[model samples]
Target: MHPARRSAGWMQTRFFVMKKKLLSLILTGLGILVLPNAALGAEPKTIGELVTKISNALYSAMSGIVLIAWIVIAFLYLTAWGSPEKLKTAHHAVIWAAVGTAILVLYKSIEPIIKNALGV
Candidate 1:
């Protein structure tokens, strides 16, 4: 096989392996967050309650993710060591993380309005 083609095949394999590992890590994290609630918490008796529970879980997960993002961005900023490119990348990450946090805040703010509107 051509060396170029062989290298491309190896890259693809590595990419797939990385994706698989990421997926498993995500699943494990979610299970750790969710399984205890499922096993120990009482079941929702109404649809509204169920929806509330799901939304609460989603909010918790998103908040955790945002916190992690901020930590990662902080690390990036600290390690940039005055390199322009690394600083730029860290700045971009900060902006994205801020946007994510804003969205979460909006969701939290509007959730009460929504629940009141729906009488849930």
Candidate 2:
């Protein structure tokens, strides 16, 4: 009877752990994909015709920035692992990332450029 009770407890613990892990993954993915969009004035909707709805100009630009950043990060990560050639690719990614970051910073300082380029 004691052994059966122990087995039951172990199963319950394993179930709880799995549930926690699944929830964590879901929340993390949501944070990466949706948080910045919301923060930047973009709303994500599954029911709508379009995927994302942009509310304001600044918000839209921010969402664009967020998207670009994530893509760059993904690219950098994709090349960061494995052989020497990949490492060199990662190094170039890092350099491009630095340039991108500089551009982003300049963009913040100079809104007129984006406004003019966007024709807004």
Candidate 3:
């Protein structure tokens, strides 16, 4: 009826769509990452085992995602057509992705020491 009310309804619909898309993307990524372990028959029978399996799967998935993000950032930077906003976004993406990858690598490297200490 009113223009302002109509615009607000449209904005709400757009927000819902974006939220749904993000949720689907996350679910698909998790399914893709977990399918390999499922096919390999790494079924967890206990809560601790499930936690470890999920942790390992998440690390592996994050490693792949970080690598892909770096590649995407590189492409973004190269094909930015001299756009300042695009370059800035790409730069930020690269910095955050690199930091995430480094943290994951550090955790993996120290995982053995942690396991030894815990005697798991």
Among the numbered candidates, top TM-score falls to: 1
Alpha carbon lDDT of each predicted model: 0.77, 0.57, 0.73
Residue by residue across 1-120, what tens digits does model 3's lDDT show?
999999878976886686678657766876787678667666777655665676677787776677667756766786576999999999899889889888988866665565566666
Model 2: residue 15 alpha-carbon error in angstroms? 24
TM-score of candidate 1 against the unseen true structure: 0.63
Clashes of each: 0, 0, 0
Name the runs in model 3 displaced over 4 angstroms: 1-33, 42-52
Q: What is the C-alpha RMSD of each candidate to the true structure, in Å?
A: 6.8, 12.1, 7.9
lDDT of 3 at 67: 61
Lowest lDDT block of 10, candidate 1: 31-40
Cα lDDT tens digits for candidate 1, 1-120: 899999878977886786678657765775677665566578899767776777777787787688768866876786676999999999999999999999998876766676777887
- lDDT of predicted model 2: 0.57
> Which regions of candidate 2 are displaced past 4 Å?
1-82, 112-120
